[model samples]
Target: MTAARAAGAHADAVPDLVPDAAPSAAPDAVREPAPVTPEAVAAARHDLYTDGITACRGAFGAEWADRLREDIEAAFDEARRRPGGAVGRGPHRYYVEIHPEQMRGFAELADHPWVRGVCEAVLGPEYAIVELGFDIPFAGAVNQPWHRDFPSPELTRTERRLTSLAFNVTAVDTEEDMGPFEIAPGTQWEHGDGFEHGMFPPRGEFPRYESLAVRKYPCRGDISARSALTLHRGTTNHSATARPVLVLGVDAPGAGNDAHHDMAVTRAYRDALPERVRAHLHCPVVDELAPIVQKHTIEGLVMGDA
Candidate 1:
């Protein structure tokens, strides 16, 4: 089936979008039973709209979390062993995209109900996965400048609304010293060349916004959903180990035609996934997955040249 048709089939299976507010309940009331209930979906939608991001703790169980962590570590090792496997964009930042086929354990998360619910609420029911990769910042890696995932400074506020969402899953417990992900709350609404440049102004120029940046320390299994336009950065990793986070991009139908980060999985793998999951992955399926290698440097990382 065509990619668009696949996306439509996937959308048809999603539950109806929920309202922005849940039923009134006391602060001490009992919690909902389901992991992605209508109430939970509504609250997540509200946060994404108001704060530009939502952090869902324990979104996945310990079993899934443990498997993903192990797979990620194995992928890292494999990448390093392969010729030109590890691409260094900076002192300690390694760029790698673990093909979905190789990391099936983590790839299945794309079809998890809770994940689909959030994507449906934020990017509409017709959303599709445009890219998936691993972002590993090892010890001594420098902080990344604040930036947006896409460049579209000319789009109006309404034009940019919910066009794409980024779902990040941490592979390990993110501690303060680990240089967790940080973001400027509510900055997703800001538009213009300054915010669209894909890199923020120097700290001296925007001290207040820089100072207001909040650090997010999410434990393993936590999922963070945010607009692709949000102002955020990956902080420096000071610990002895590497910090690897899985990054998945879901875009509203027709929103990512010009995206540069498109990825492809093997045909066998694509055919193996359930129809529900296949719909989200609309990219081409190749006969064999190839290694992605790129030059790495601090300047390249800051400029996004890599």
Candidate 2:
């Protein structure tokens, strides 16, 4: 009958939002378990990634793959001009490239309807984009130490906070053998200053949080994101191929979570996004009072990169 109906037939909503897959030897091998259909992948993704929900992959195709490729390319192009402190030789990663149109387009993916529902599920309709970015791990990239993006209040500090979220482009497609990122869900809610920067390890070396990292590493051809408070990290990219990903940040509209405390600096980078894309995500629409878009800096872990 209905897709949601069928998904619900075999699965009960799990607290994590990401319910378990069909009983199989490769449980976390990326699947579309019944009840947790691709339609529900976002729901399951959010749950497993954030509120502890999980679903299965019901839909997959070339169109989806191509779209992912395009976005990854756009993000990379944006990253080239983007700036931040350097970690050895890699990019500092401070600006989010996906503008409104891209954000809307990404949400429109037939296979990811659950993403919108999940975002609405947590923050409600008024929720504006908090933050979104793309990650391209080069062959020699360093391990993005275990950490959690804190939902720090904005400069205005008036209840304005954004949540951390993401989806996979599967540029490299991860399995136990290879990986782009590894997640430790709910550790964002685990309530501890855990890890080097408050992150939950996906596997070994975490003599502490490793015990809770029971979830299998997500295989490639998957999409994932987490609540504002979820603990995670972009572990070392062991694969020879560059692992590219499109990242998204979700923050309420008009809550003081703009580029940063320095409106001028915010304008510089926010203005840097593709004009068309910016118009799509208009959180008051990028205001270019200045003639030339230039660089400016923020105070501290302002979150959302730029």
TM-score: which candidate is best? 1
lDDT digits (tens) for residues 27-60 of candidate 2: 3334542454445544454465444424324233
* Best lDDT among the predictions, by candidate number: 1
**Ten contiguous residues minimizing lDDT sum, candidate 1:** 11-20
Q: Quote model 2's TM-score.
A: 0.56
lDDT of 1 by residue, 3-59 (tens): 123224332221111112322222222322256787888888888877788867676
What are the models' TM-scores? Answer: 0.78, 0.56
Question: Quick one: how many clashes does candidate 1 have?
Answer: 3
lDDT of 1 at 203: 46
What are the per-model C-alpha RMSD values against the true structure?
Answer: 12.1, 13.7
Model 1, position 258: C-alpha lDDT score: 25
Off by over 4 Å in 1: 1-34, 81-89, 153-160, 195-198, 294-300, 303-306
Q: Which stretches of candidate 2 lie over 4 Å from their true place?
A: 1-60, 81-96, 100-107, 110-112, 151-169, 192-205, 214-221, 252-257, 260-280, 284-306
